[model samples]
Target: MHQLNSLEKRAAIALALVFSTRMLGLFMLLPVFALYGEQLVGFSPLWIGLAIGAYGLTQAILQIPFGWLSDKIGRHKVMLLGLSLFVLGSVVAALAESVYMVTLGRVLQGAGAIAGAVLALAADLTREEQRPKVMAIIGASIGLSFAVAMVAGPLLARWAGLSGVFWFTAVLAVCAMLIVAFLVPKSVSKAPMAETLALPQSLAAMLKHGQLLRLDAGVLILHLMLTAMFVALPALLNQQHLAAERHWQVYLPVLLGSFLFMVPMMIIAMRRQQEKRYFLINVLLLVIAMLICWQATTLWGLVLALLVFFIGFNFLEASLPAMVSRVAPAGQRGSAMGIYSSSQFFGAFLGGLLGGAVAQQFGFVAIFAVLAGIGLVWLAIASTMQVPSRAQRLSLPVAVTTEQQAAALAAKLAALAGVQEVTILLADQRCYLKVSAQQFELAQAQSLVAVGNQ
Candidate 1:
């Protein structure tokens, strides 16, 4: 196991805090926004749904550009700018008295678009062996923030109303800014690593990759179902005579149950190297949740349905990025992640749009049917996904003077024990490899080329 250095530890902690804080701000609105927006001027179900998902649209648009800008400027500078935009958007939403303005505020909020930049920075600050652990910590933090926000959103709205939530997020954004400026140390580049920054030119090839495409589509459909479900769920609960303020009581216990179910499955998957089987089962769980919702008659049945839904949601959220990292071609991981993130946000937008429209025209039951259909589509796609190799990403520095030399060296490494794939960057004196954990001999690999994790 690679130990985290002092800087890596500090960076991971600070970055995770920043990420969780930002996500909490975003998610804290999901459960309560629909109810409170009815009091605003020009409010309607469709606009409320659009308001809920508007942030995703802007986020999808700017994620790549912000990351590219971070590469040009410094990471902290870009992060600060993103945070500033987030705070401004929060304030706008806080002051708005109309649904259209709220939609504008949500769009502004999405414009921060810092997820790619944050992940890139995390990659820059950690070693290859330690990167997965660090990323996992950050990913877990984001997931926890979502869980917390789901509970907190309703409770806070009950006490302070919708505007209060926006004000609170603005405060959180300010704290995030302080952390970015003071607590987080500057990242020092170790070597030119492909996974750390987006490469626009590589997008075409990554899109064509069957395995990567499956993961991308999976994330898209997953989030689409999530946002769409929430668009109609609150109303369904209201129809069942559950007060809006009491929704948290239902969300809290179900979220906990989902977490309990999710953690064990993730552990078993990792321990036994059963990524494909676990993924397939989780997708089926989601399908079952949708089916349960389709027939739900009581609040308790709905609770059980959400429990199953989140179990699948949380599992896929945790595993999908790891899958993307493993399957993406070397030197293109960042671009691949950018696309993945964009797809996720875009799905949120489409879900809100489509879900709200469906709910308005038909009923919440129709929304459930639509989401169930989506789950079935995802099941088909996920079934065809390639199982990720049980290898960690490792970077090796080689002494190659020519393109031909680098190519020859990469071929040599490919035949070595434990090596599954290799991509040599002729311009960078570096080679990226996927090596089997049980079979990879780091010492032998280093003998051929001066090995270092990029």
Candidate 2:
């Protein structure tokens, strides 16, 4: 197995911290906002839910634009600008006296939209072969951050109230900025590739891809249920006589226990090559969890429901992105991911809106009932998704000085047995290929490229 070099390691750690800190700032608000938000002027279930999800709306809109801008100017500059907006938004929320002001602050925070830039920068800093590991590290950090935020949010709220939480978020944003400015290794300036950067022209084709669209909708619905659940979960806990500060006691155990169950399922699915099977099972698990939440009458009952929910949530969260990578057309992964991410953020926005509306009209428990229905719809759609074949992506450096040469090389590579897709970039001096895992012969491909170069 290949290993990341010292520089790759440093870049991975620093960027992971940056990603985690920003995510933590966002997630901390998820668990505590409902309970403490009531203290603000103009507080209502609708406004509180909107405030919670308001950042997602802007994040959905601007993530791609920020990514494209980073390609135009530079990654570091765009990241700094995004982090600055985040810090400013956090401060605004910290000082807000009304829920609407807090919502405005959240919107500003979303406007920062650094996720795409961060990924692009990571792509710049690592080798193609090592990129998956780097991304896994970053993804793991986001998950860890969420677990920590769930526990820490309530504790912080107990100590400093909601404003204090926002203040802490602002501090985190500053730390991320510092990481971007000083810690992350500088990347070589190059033209962004369709593999790593979103190309606007490719958007429509990705939208029309049935498998990609299904994955996109899956993420959207998953996040929608998540944000909507929080809209009422805190209040439900409070009603069950659990104090706000003590909510962490429940979150810590449930999260930990859920991982215990989730990891085994993940391993089994991978080992058996039964991802679609497990995927459907996890989706069904979510539905069951929501139904449990609807009927739970005691604290323990709700805890059990949450345990089930997280077990499914964590697995799906990790799996969906991987599926998107596998299902995406060769050379167009960037555009597919851009659309998928936007859908996720938009889902969060909708979750807040719809979750709040349902909770306001029908009460908190009703939100779960609605979510369960949505899960069924997703389950039905997902049932028809084709299992992604085992495919390996290989990036090979080729000596080609002209567009015609590059085109000739691409055509030759595409003719190789087991090659599923091929993309050649003349400026990058590389050919990107997706090939069958079992049938692709590295030696054969290398020999062909060598002969062509000679």
Candidate 3:
């Protein structure tokens, strides 16, 4: 409940704006691209789907490496390079006359992966306690961008055409670059933050954990189902007599209604500690959406199905990061998140390939069947997940000159009352602890670390 100071608020808003700006440009094509892609030479259902998801393939491949590069170079410098690449990709897409060219442009767009760097920068700018709020702000911005893109992308494409959409994206990328240079506050500390960069050594542990793996798989499948569904959705709407230009009419209501339903369910799940239950419910809802798509005879029924799907999508979108944080070991959150993001993007790429192939051979409706099968598998995996822990992680800066000193301090802190886990990272000059808030004595722990600071 602590309020963010002016600096924290500024960093959060500026980062959120940067994130939203880039995502808005990317998502703006989701609702209309499949339809508009038809106008390209060498266009087919398969290539159209590839054009929609090719960005994810390169994004997944480069996401971690880009963040690692940011650590060696300055964050702002990395961001500048990434944004420049993005602008170049947008220009390529704008000039593309064939689906193959569009796919290549999308691949280049994904090559500029900078999400990890942006997150690292946010972590550096905020205190440990305030980082969650900053992440939440950034997360909300992404969700808002998706909703707005669904509506605005179609509208913009209606007037300007698909190429015009890419031109606008290039303009937005330039604006984001300016914001990075001027609006973002510089990090004052050179401390190595576990929340900012992933450690390669931690990769095995992060991947092997049962809970974290499940969550990671869930995200990958969630995005896979989403991208795959969209591959056919635009065409289906055509069957229902809704033109691509008018698609927003359905999306606007679906997003609004889904948000209204999603918020309450999230609150209830948190209050009742029924995260697993609600997560399973959402998975099932996705399955139901697929089934409805498979059998629906009316447009209104399809709209209703979309509402259900969004309700589940929105809830999971909000909760998945929280789930990851809860299960991740102290001091290795960045690694966990990086792996999770890779999985999610990979899902998008695979979904496009799978959906496109199925649509081309079996027909549009069969894509729904394929997605439903995937949903059921996800539901089975999710059902095995335990309820997420409510304990909070606290980071304490400590001075330690040797590995032995750090170990001794870690042992001492581990023996403290209410401390569930301790991780002392000497290189970072910090120790991370997980504890129940009600039982934790922050004053005493702060006193212990304060001596080191002095």
Tens digit of per-residue lDDT, candidate 1, span 1-454:
2489988899899999999999999998889887877899988778867988899999989998998898889789999999999999999999999988888988998999988778888888887768877888898899889989988898889899999999999999999999999998888783354676667777788889898889999998998888888888888888889998899999999999998999999999989989899999999888899889889999988998999999999999889988888888766677788899999999889888888898889877788888888888888998888876666778877677777777767877888888988888766667888888899888888877753321
**After best superposition, candidate 2 residue 146: deviation in angstroms?**
0.3
What TM-score would every model get versus the actual structure? 0.95, 0.96, 0.96
Better of 1 and 3 by lDDT: 3
Instruction: List where candidate 2 sits over 4 angstroms from the true fold.
Output: 189-192, 397-411, 425-430, 450-454
Question: How big is the positional error of residue 76 in model 3, measured in Å on the Cα after superposition?
Answer: 1.0
lDDT, residue 129, candidate 1: 68
Worst lDDT run of 10 residues, candidate 3, spans 188-197
Looking at model 1, the pairs that clash are: none
Pairs in clash, predicted candidate 2? none
TM accuracy, model 1: 0.95
Tens-place lDDT digits, model 3, residues 111-138: 8899988998888888777888998999
Once fitted onto the true fold, the runs of candidate 1 whose alpha carbons sit more than 4 angstroms away are 399-401, 450-454
Report residue 67 deviation for candidate 1 (angstroms). Answer: 1.1
What is the lDDT of every predicted structure here?
A: 0.86, 0.92, 0.87
User: How large an RMSD does model 2 have?
Assistant: 1.9
